[model samples]
Target: MNTPPSKDALREFLASKFAEAVEQNPDAVVLYAAERAPDPKRYVKRPTVQEVAFKRELEKMRDDQADKAAPESATSVSPAIRTNQLSLDDYPGLVLPGKHNEF
Candidate 1:
């Protein structure tokens, strides 16, 4: 009666077998591995011209809506006026006689 190999022995045997197979026909093993690999092309779908055009149109519509929602007077502002209402007494360091008497 034959006894089964231990897990370590089995793993080593399998690794040696795989290495031997890889050495024998490298291209075939590569192709086989590639076949088993997850296909990025399978998940890829081409976007139609209409779909691209529609997305562009939607973006343009959003920009137009933003422009329309803005206030009409957004750029409008009155110019600053020059005034002579200020006096020499309003300026700093102008000494007034009765000003410190109140403090």
Candidate 2:
């Protein structure tokens, strides 16, 4: 069996595919797809000193929003894995027909 692609490899493959699709079908209405963000240095104009300060303050304001273990973006990148904590309480009708009416 073929091994699964690593996350980075999958992302690169997707980015390339999207680029191709856009090239072939610029008029296509894409519903959902992940495209790599363009390089800020190449695309974005250099910010003024005042704009830089404003950006920093905006980031600080976003960080101040109500108590949370981490930013919402943090969990989305790599979600935590949790196991189901099943217990007898989950099945009140299950019984082996022994002690206390159950074995």
Candidate 3:
């Protein structure tokens, strides 16, 4: 009695068969299915310097507002919206380029 073929062996056999079928019939649409690992580089969207600065400024503002609203309960707040203790810094992106500067 012959033992069953392993998954890898079966996949190889099927792939070869599909390749042969395509070779034999030029017009045939034989789907060659294979699982591929995700490429990390393809999924990454690196933020610009300006974008990073803007995000930090926004977080700092939120923390400041939260602190002012509830000084006592600020420490007792949930983990998600907790302050990151961001330092105050100049946000050039937040300022408008005009004679009357706007934030």
Q: After superposition, which runs of candidate 2 have C-alpha atoms over 4 Å from their true positions? A: 29-103
**lDDT-sorted candidate list, best first:** 3, 1, 2
Error of 2 at 26 (Å): 0.7
Return whichever of 1 and 2 wins on TM-score.
1
Error of 2 at 100 (Å): 99
**RMSD of model 1, in Å?**
16.1
Ranking by TM-score: 1, 3, 2
**Residue 93 lDDT in model 1?**
72
Best by lDDT: 3
Overlapping backbone residue pairs in candidate 1 total 0
Q: Provide the global lDDT of candidate 1 against the true structure.
A: 0.73
CA lDDT of every candidate: 0.73, 0.73, 0.76
lDDT of 1 at 6: 100
Q: Tell me the tens digit of each residue's lDDT in model 2 across 26-100.
A: 987557788899866656578999999999998887877633646665656332222345545556766545645
**TM-scores for candidates 1 onward, in order:** 0.31, 0.27, 0.30
